[model samples]
Target: MIKIVLLGAGNVATHLYKGFKKANTVNVVQWYNRNLKSIETYKNEVKITDNVNNLIEADVYIIAVNDDAIPELSSTLPFENRLVVHTSGSARLYDIDQKLYRGVFYPLQTFSKAVDLDFTTVPICIETLRKKDFKLLETLGQSLGCVTYKVNPKQRPALHLAAVFVNNFTNQIYRIAHEITEKQGAEFDILKPLITETARKVQEVSPYIAQTGPAKRNDKKTIKRHLKLLDNPDQEAIYKLMTESIKKTHGH
Candidate 1:
């Protein structure tokens, strides 16, 4: 079994730890973090340490810390005799120094502390320190049932940006719609079918082809009605911009 050390106790770490443990191919010999108390509960099951120097020898170190903390954390870890990886979609592997076996293992999905996640469906993007490390990563990815993609820093950043548009921005739109529904004294749950249908269409049709609404049809009447319905100027602006974008995409 490949020995591993996992850093951090946050969303990424928790999910990865669960999945890696389930795989049984990896032996999590040690887990390190800045705050000793953060992982106090798991101390008995897995050796947890606050001091970087006390880290147990492992074949690979998976750094799942916050984005800003990665470089500082990487600097402290003993990178020799081990492969080192971070799990951020936006951060490049080379952002950290090359003194050690450095790479990125970005999982392309938003993680929430409160929510349960299925790592099987999460797209795992792997970049590596060397050709030797590639096989190790691929093996780990398969254990989790992930759809793996080999991505470089530049391409990873682009995919991350697209994720923001599709996931983050889409969630924001949902929030706005929910608020509007509440204001109208209607259950926001009423829109669940429409939202599901939108997602379903995308799987079969290109997003450009699946798009519909006042914007896609160039229906001035519906556009004006929605704008009138929304009291918030920000919502109106978003609707207007999306409408224009859809029209431009569909060649309306």
Candidate 2:
């Protein structure tokens, strides 16, 4: 069995625990968090401790803490020459103490504690200190039904930045649309089909090719009307900025 120790109790850590529970070949030997109460719920299910010194000997130690905390935590670990990884898309693998094996096991998906996600569709990006160690991570990813890829640490940052534009920025735009609809006393559900279709279209075609809107068409009159409709200066500015971006992208 692949014995593993998981550190942290945030969304990524919680989801990893749940996913590991379903894999028969994997064993969660222990869970560690700075605050005992944070992961107390799993006490009955597995060994839990708040002290890093109490960590058990395991095949791998997965640190799923914030990016900034990764360096300090990894440096403070009492063990050495053990397989240690962080679940951060942008964090440099070299940031982990040179005394230990460093790697990244970034799951490319947004995680929410209250939401259930199917691991099969998630892409698991792996990077390891030793080339041979990648096989173990690949096995772990496959066990969770994820599509795994060996990503270079240098390339990982660009991938993370692209994700921000597609996921984070797009979600914020959706929130703005929802607010606008609510202000007009309209049901946000009315735009659900359009949103769904937009997402679907991008899967079948390039986003550039799938683009369709007044901005894409360079309909200045319609653009002016949209800007006039939004009363908030912030919203109006965003509308104008996006329209200009679309026009620039399409070479209009």
Give the best candidate by lDDT: 2
Tens-digit lDDT string for candidate 2 (53-161)? 9999998899999999999999999999999999999999988889999889999999999999899989999999788679988998888999999999677888899
Per-candidate TM equals: 0.95, 0.98
**How high is the lDDT of residue 154 in model 1?**
80
lDDT of 2: 0.93
Best by TM-score: 2
TM-score of predicted model 1? 0.95
Clashing pairs in 2: none
Residue-level lDDT tens digits of model 1 in 194-215: 9999988988988767776778
